[model samples]
Target: MAQKAPWKTNRRKLDITPLLVTNHCPDNIWPGISTQSGTGPGQNGFQLKPGETKNQTVSEDWQGRVWGRTNCSFNHDGTASASGQGKACLSGDCNGALNCRVGGDVPVSLAEFTLDAGDGHTYYDISLVDGYNVPMAIVLQPLENITLDDIPPNLTNPSCQGTDGLLAPQGYNPYPEYPDFLRTNTSYPLPFDQDVDENKISRWCPWDLQQTPPEKPGDGVYPYPDDNIQRPQFNPCYSACAKNNQPQDCCTGKYNSPSACKPSEYSKNVKSVCPDAYSFAFDDQTSTFIIPSGAGFEVVFCPGARSTTILSTSRAEMLQLSQQGKVDKQATIGLKRASASKLRRNAASTTFRLDRTLLTVTVVLTVVASVHVFC
Candidate 1:
């Protein structure tokens, strides 16, 4: 044998997928982007006007977060103000820059992604764990060969059932633990509650966690004293971690483990409203979603009663629900009340059985003692 040639192996290239962000809100919104892993696309931030849609691309192994910045006004040179008001975004401001070099400020509704995370799957979720600023949804775009059955159950679509008249689309599977308080508590403001005063009161966010406007007026960017502009008081809701910074709320220090750090009242309420989104740290079971990589996605702002064809449910039932409009308020309340009463009855029955068992044991002991005395 004169000579032997070395064998060569072929390496596969990573795929690039499209990410389309649509603004369905009435006003302008700036979509802020940040990369957490691998090589990012470098397109950090831009503005999307009402009804406008922007498209970006990401690598197969990319990991990042996207959020919307509301009521933003930047200088001609793309520099925002440092005053924390006006000339900057009311929520999700990236520290005086139109193009974010870092993650936006908290209380922003987050749509997070990690492509090719594990086992050739991509992971994503809508997170209100940091709190919520606007309604958002992450929908996997339909591909040529992929069908609803091919998609993973949790990875289909995660939409925030947020304020600003947003509702969970028909046939969308909500979190399993969706509480009845969301239906029966008259005090908990429903999305379609006509009596809600958006300007004066918070629609659904807790009063203590509501974000307040800047104390001083700005140079027309925010337009503080403009009576013509209708302002919403509860536009952004703050998380307990961001507002209080306690170890328990932030899941830090001794409360870092899942067992140690349980959901707070704030997290529970938020979870009830937006079950598809993460309500607190370590809320992985119900919030995180995973699917095989290689599909495009759409991030929709202010999604209304859109078709739930891509959801993991019957299309016909969804259509029927869409036609029926809002849920039956009276029926929902009655069902919740009945459920509570049944739980109470079960508890009482258990107590009664325990007492009867104890009485029988006492009588048996007394009879045994009398038999011994007679002998």
Candidate 2:
């Protein structure tokens, strides 16, 4: 053998597929609410205006969550205020930045996931153990050439039956405000507006939280009169950890283990509103789903929200509901679209892009208004 040449084979490049994250919220219904995710392009925060849809891309192994932040403010310096009232969010405050540089503060309705998270499956769940800020749903939008039959029965459809509202085109309107006593969501049978202990008054709980800077070195609350804006409320929605220093509720100490820790009263309260989501430390059987790779997703803010398509009932049905509720239908009254959009310190600089295709129409079909039944 004169010469034997050594052979070298080329190594194949690994294919890293991009995951498209398409998100949207109820059109024009929730203007103030902002949606966000972590360990991805969402570090700088993302907003989907009412009836708006925005798409972003992430990697296969990305570990993160999708949730909503309310009552947030940021300075032009990109630094949010302290105590989660100023620059940070009063609820779901993430690392105290307009841009979430780290995981968010607790008591959030988390859409937790580790994309393509080993075992050839995506581990995901909507957890309420930290507590809930807004109702969210992560929908796996079907794709071509993908066998979705393996998708667990629980993961096939949307999650969370969010608050219901109007059917536009024919007419979009709100029902009259009930009396304060009646308006109180604490009233049972259907305390839909109340979150658990009735502290979370709908999505816009307490309406306004105390930007009243943390009480120096004290645990009690402080009120402001000299400064009109910093007024504080007696009962505000606080996370489990904030409510109690108990290690179990905080998920600290030995209670960190699933078997060691148990669901608290707060978790049960949130579970009442969002049944499908993770209500506690070990709610895997009901809250989470494991799926094979390569699936597109749609995180709808108010999942199962009633809209025009589902509301197009016969006039007779509307009339009957109206008669039953004693609602006035003949007269057309006007109510300004409520804006939960808080007046942040950096109000001018914060911006969001709206998808025109989504903004243009409410739904495929048109229906007359029977505002009572829908709104």
| lDDT to native, each model | 0.57, 0.40
Across 119-218, the per-residue lDDT of candidate 1 in tens digits comes to 4445688888888887777877534323222323222565564564334222222122222211212222112211222232234565467676333334
Task: Point out where model 2 deviates above 4 Å.
Answer: 1-39, 76-85, 149-154, 161-239, 256-259, 304-375
Per-residue lDDT, model 2, residue 317, is 23
- Tell me the tens digit of each residue's lDDT in model 2 across 1-375: 001111211121323323332233333211121223323543336444444555555655666666665555556664656443543565566665755655556545566666554444555666666555455556554343123322222223334432323111111111111111111111110111112222232332222222222343333434343222232331124446544567887667898887887776655544554555565556555455544544455555543221211011122322322233111333111101111121121123334332222122232322233322111
**Which clashing pairs does model 2 show?**
27-50, 27-51, 28-50, 32-341, 80-87, 81-87, 107-130
Show how many residue pairs clash in every candidate, following the order shown: 0, 7
Pairs clashing in candidate 1?
Answer: none
lDDT of 2: 0.40
Go through the candidates in order and give the C-alpha RMSD of each one to the true structure: 22.2, 18.0
**Among all windows of ten consecutive residues in candidate 2, which has the lowest summed lDDT?**
331-340
